[model samples]
Target: MFEGVDLEVPAGGLLVAHGPAGCGRTSLLLALAGRMRLSGGAIRVGGYVLPAAGRRVRATVAVARAAPAVALEGRLRVKEVMAERRLTGAGVTERRIREAFETVGIAPRGSDLVEDLGPLQALLLATALALAERPGALVVDDVDEGLPPDAHGSVWQALDRVRNSGPGPTVLAGCVRTPPPASGLVALSLPRRSLDRLPAETAAAREDTAT
Candidate 1:
């Protein structure tokens, strides 16, 4: 549950939701992506209001979960992932896929199996998939996890490119610490709260501040 949470991300701005482990960062991301139930308040993406009854927000928003435990069919090759997404109605083209891989600095080959890549590569591939959807807003949890400190800048630079590419997508990423310089990222910190106890007024105040 998130309390006192208020934030506004400008179109195409990179917003980082920074906090410690178990802080409501992931939950907040899930809520914004319309994957979790919110007991109160509003979530708006572009001009559409989320959590409205029967309103589908997933079509315009994309989320890449922290740790990105996405199950890839081990038999599928890297190119197949892009191909399958296109076949399934995602607007990804071969060129776009190639470009996304290049943006993330990955050399995606047709013969490379998903399971053969290390964790960082897998995360980058997942990000590429999300980009292929051409969402108006992108939510990524733990943008820097599992990556060596030296590699953070390159990864953030790629994300910066994605953000600046057009009226592109608004990015909301969660992290445990301050992000690197290239993220062009601003932050909103979620407060620590006890799950067993409800502090309604306190949460409300934080939300007030966030807005």
Candidate 2:
């Protein structure tokens, strides 16, 4: 839905993809994380290139809470989710989970269900889960949705911490609007283009087929 968008993010930097809905913000993040294939153009994440080396890229990239692709099921408990990640071969452990929780500054009870978390807490949990994997890059979508404007800073700050964490993973986060500037935080705006008028299902089908 967008065209001619070029990006260059430093390792461990936070790149905010900001735009209105249907402007390809989510698509761009997915593509960068190697979770979605691009119809055109090239992407290079560290030493890996798009599409051709997608498998290698995916091995070191983690996508979290990026709707439809990665999301917490309401019925699952916090500990269950962590266990599932471990089952999937992520290096998830109680200690790593604790580290992630500390970085995100939240500690939901292990017995608590995903739905019980508030908006910010849910986001924080997703972030922690992704970070616990220790991926080379992390992608998060809708970073500022379902919360008050005042609370936006918390999400940004948590992401900043992720960026600053030692040998941090490159972070790609989406938002409806750009937040204030911060060190190593870069903002890229995606304007709605003609292709954005395509129906959602059609876009999804295109992504599915390409990938």
| Number of the top lDDT candidate | 2
Model 1's alpha-carbon lDDT is 0.66
TM-score result, candidate 2? 0.89
Q: What TM-score does each of the candidates earn?
A: 0.81, 0.89
Name the regions of candidate 2 deviating beyond 4 angstroms. Answer: 196-211
TM-score of 1: 0.81
lDDT of 2: 0.77
Query: How would you encode candidate 2's per-residue C-alpha lDDT over 117-157 as one tens digit per residue?
Result: 88999898999988888888788899988988889999998
Which lDDT values do the candidates have, in the order given?
0.66, 0.77
Candidate 1 Cα errors over 4 Å, as ranges: 53-55, 66-76, 181-184, 195-211
Per-residue alpha-carbon lDDT of model 1 for 1-211, expressed as tens digits? 6666656676777887787777777777776676766676677666556567314566666765544333346578987877886776356677777776776678867789987876678767877777766777777787777788887777677778777756557777877778765444567876566443212321110111100
